[model samples]
Target: MDAKQTNGGRRHFLKTGAAAGLALKVGVTAAEPRASTPALPMPEYEKLDALALASAIREGRLTALEALEAAIARAEARSQINAVALRHFDLARENAQRLSRMGRAERAAWAQTAPLAGVPFALKDLGVAMKGTVTTQGCAFFKDAVADHDSTLVQRYRAAGLNIFAKTTTPEFGQTATTESRLFGLTRNPWNLAYSAGGSSGGAAAAVAAGIVPAAHASDGGGSIRIPSSHCGLFGLKPSRGLVPMGPKMLEGWLGLSAQNVISRSVRDSALLLQLTQGPEAGSRTGPQPGALIDAITRPPRRLRIALMEQNPFGAPVHPECLDAVRAAARLCESLGHVVEMAAPKLAIGEMFGSMGIATAAGMLASVRMREKETGRTAREDEFEPLNWRSLQLARGYSAEQAFTARTVFDQAARTVDLFLGEYDLILSPVTAAPAPLLGAMSLDQPYESFVKVAMTASPFTAIFNMTGHPAMSVPLHWNGAGMPIGAQFAAPFGAEATLLALAAQLEQAAPWKDRRPVL
Candidate 1:
């Protein structure tokens, strides 16, 4: 693809930063829509959001089996995107068929009780687990690591009656922003296949964008969910750390820098999903008291102070288009009666990056060591990505004292941001420094320096909230001249998801994005 076509058929260069590199070529699925064999008309189910789908099932307008089949057909038709990591179509069909066989009263009871009942969904092939299914974190070594039991979050999803019919792609251990993995290959953007579907939740974001599912699970450690959402044109939110459960397998994800939720075309789906899944699990940390998140979105938000920061906190250059997106979002907030200021927190970004490096490297070492014990052997070089290998190597040189000191730095950074947030109810920023990079821009096999540069450049704005355990979201408020989606990020204080949701809903009303489907 030419430079123009690669960036959604538009011409521009924003000085590509590097990340873990892509291992494959991106296709033209986005530049030009796919030409597939004209299959029979699918049920009109694909056009509906998750809540609408569930309501249809409950109202006897569609059977669960019929809905699942429609989604399966869409998934099969769009297989060229390489978004699906593991398909559960047959299993889902069987389960839905069983549900269809129930009495009318029973079916209504099931649908009424489960908010997502009969809605087709997918889990990103990372942190969360499903019993008896492969929980491969996009690594060859863990290819055989079948989950023995459902993670707490998965249990909640099941209870909500979401028909999880597939697992979506992620980078190895969700280590980078782009989703291409040596184990699962590349997951390209549905908007423009020549570009990346930002990772490590790229597959889920891509699948949802391609209309295979209305929503899919996504986890953000370092902008995984928001990055993909920004690239794929969806609503993605990362809950405050310690708010969402990560139990049965883990008490915390990436030392509380990670949180899991779903990427959806509609804000209500995301807000409702959080309402369904948010709360503590066994061995989980306490979070803010719960409230009706779905109801919160229905109410108009109070006018509040919002800071608009378009520059990179580390002094890296942000792309002009990305800065434009943030500015546009800020203007929209102003029109909505919110106070918008051009401001950012004063913190030592360099020091924070250094400390994060230490903590991440140590975490990678522990993960590799745990896998080593599981396999009863050390990790073979070929089994791990080069970027992850480098992390392991860097971790080997760090001591426990260094790790503790790094933790203190994170604490300080969080405190600093907390104080800054005291004066402002929200921080508005660009979700990424630029539009989605071309496939192979941040290959996993690339040198360590090139990879980190691209990764950081691509996602400079979203990770600080993760570090601070604050609630953050990427709302699809703008699309660049390239036609590539560029999301504006909004972060609120710890456990302030309701505020974020309310604002998101108001924005969704002012500028609807659900109807903006990609060509794919």
Candidate 2:
């Protein structure tokens, strides 16, 4: 956590800016409008995705400060969604001003090196860390926790020249499928505030959907990125395990059931993010070499054999609207020249779920113990929700043999899915059993059994790939009758993100969801 080690060479770039005066003028609150400056024309700001915004800044059509202010204005306007966990508006403004003040030649050079320079961005308040910033992880136990160093991924984000302005909410330890917690309150969906913004990356999804930022850093332990994207009508990709770094603190999350990526409004932004951050840091256990992910965005994938799965693997009845969404996506893929067939991989649902539960409980228990060690106090039961507290109890009872048995089960599931994918290019299914549910339906405070049932039904398909360590994405392709967005989940073989990105780009072009916006 040495300052020099954490900041590296970027300390001068971040700290030695002439923008301190401008930062003082902008103030610290993200929700405050800049009355001293001319009102920013927002339609243009809302229309451009992250890549387009970065391009404008590079071409001098827009100043980085203007982009940042526009994002701040939107964040203020959409305050009801409660997505902003902690704001660093002063720092963001200073960063923007510094970028705006760069010499033309210097700016041109920066553009070449930092493809996402001057773009405002947010990070989920879980997993990743930012120096001098508090990442509560949506839990009261760590409400005062401040990161001493930037996480490896945060360092990459800064190197890419993304302006890190704010952190988004998540369920405590990202333990639930909805973005509601005792600490951060409810993170409502932009499409409909009555519904939940699917979590634990829900706040990230809501921020992007609300146009606060075009894309936000999100991670998926078990469908966190994709569930929110599906609910919010955005594109989210969970890269294959080890394709995105999770290290410096820990090499893997939840025994490699997790991966870090972005929830983006555009396919290219996600592709570019993966291109920028996909690599091993020191002590990485797996080094999956980066592929041509960004280049794949421009190229249409060849005719693919897609497996269509309609039934929920967990035996929960798939909602009619969800069934309709996947069916429509299958038809669309068929029209796109991909052969579609009714197919699914056989899975031991009970074992897979049981193993996942064990892993999650073990992780939760370890995190609590680590926090206790750091704070010199044991965690109170009141600090955690009922389910997480129950997880701690469950973890205390689990033996090492049981943990290893869980890993065996996960390995078996991965092998089973790998065999299934040997005959197909991708598997297409519903991201969830239903569309975004009403807030409180998946609350962590609910009875453990009820929460488990809801969580299992809410996200059945995405976790399969999580267990298998295969690349998967939730592409926003359909809207239900109630006007909620339903995502069609597409998963590729392990380390086949190129295929997923190419197919996502093709779908984005075929059924453009760019212009779609929630009426806030």
Q: Which ten residues in a row have the lowest lDDT in candidate 1?
A: 17-26
The residue-level lDDT of candidate 1 at 310 comes to: 78
Number of backbone collisions per candidate, in order? 15, 0
Show model 2 residue runs off by greater than 4 Å. 1-41
User: Candidate 1, overall lDDT?
Assistant: 0.82
TM-score of 2: 0.91
Give the per-residue lDDT of model 2 (tens digit) for 237-351.
9999898888778888888888899998889889999999998899876756789888988879999999998899977699899899899999999999999999999999888
